[model samples]
Target: MFHYTKLDIFCNDVKKFADADGYVPEAEDICQDFSYPDTQFKGLKNWTQHIQSSVHATRSAQQKLHAWQNRL
Candidate 1:
């Protein structure tokens, strides 16, 4: 049986892999489109939120995948 400590390590490694595999420069492109001050701030804020959510999803997926790996 895999120990909880090993699972924790696996999760951390998986997060690194997911970040490398799933990262997209376009995901952070909104930071550069500062044409209008008000609108850009709002758009950037939304985009930043999206990036955060995506990263969280990727981390969750990594955790599940790692758990399956351990099961197998």
Candidate 2:
């Protein structure tokens, strides 16, 4: 798991973590437009929520299953 104190750091870390883990997100799960407004913090908050969503959970499980199968 990755963690960061700052939102920018967190976002960057997510990308790195995903790449390192070979996490290929589904089309609808892409957050390429994430932008944090100078006056608000909704972008990062939304991203945080997105990763916790059921769809993401399903995708993660599928990835794990694939990896486990490949190992067999």
Candidate 3:
């Protein structure tokens, strides 16, 4: 039996499920078996819109995302 006393959410196993977008590290350069969720909205842009309107995204998080976008 195992006893758990701490909540360590940053473990590697948890990271695997952290992907909300269809970001394949190697989208087309190689092979992949992973699948990203798709709804009425398709592609990353639409998915982002859904998150923004429904998730009540914080300003700081939005600014960070904006910075990331600018880098690209």
Itemize residue pairs with steric clashes in candidate 1.
Answer: none
Q: List candidate 2 stretches off by more than 4 Å.
A: 1-52
Would you list the C-alpha lDDT of every candidate in the order shown?
A: 0.43, 0.42, 0.34
**1-72: candidate 2 lDDT, tens digit per residue:** 322222232233334324223352333554553333334324767555645653454445556556766785
Candidate 3, residue 71: the lDDT equals 83
Shift of residue 32 alpha carbon in model 1, Å:
8.2
Query: Each model's RMSD to truth, in Å?
Result: 11.1, 10.8, 12.8
RMSD of 2: 10.8
Model 3: per-residue lDDT, tens digit, 1-72? 001111132122223322344222221221123344444445666545544532232333445556766785
Clashing pairs in 2: none
Backbone clash total for model 3 is 0
Write one digit per residue (lDDT tens) for candidate 1, span 1-72.
Answer: 111233344345333322223332224444443322345336656657645754564556557767777795
Q: Candidate 1: misplaced stretches above 4 Å?
A: 1-42
Model 2, C-alpha of 26: deviation from truth (Å): 12
TM-score of each: 0.43, 0.28, 0.24
TM-score for candidate 3, please give it: 0.24
Model 1 error, position 71 (Å): 0.6
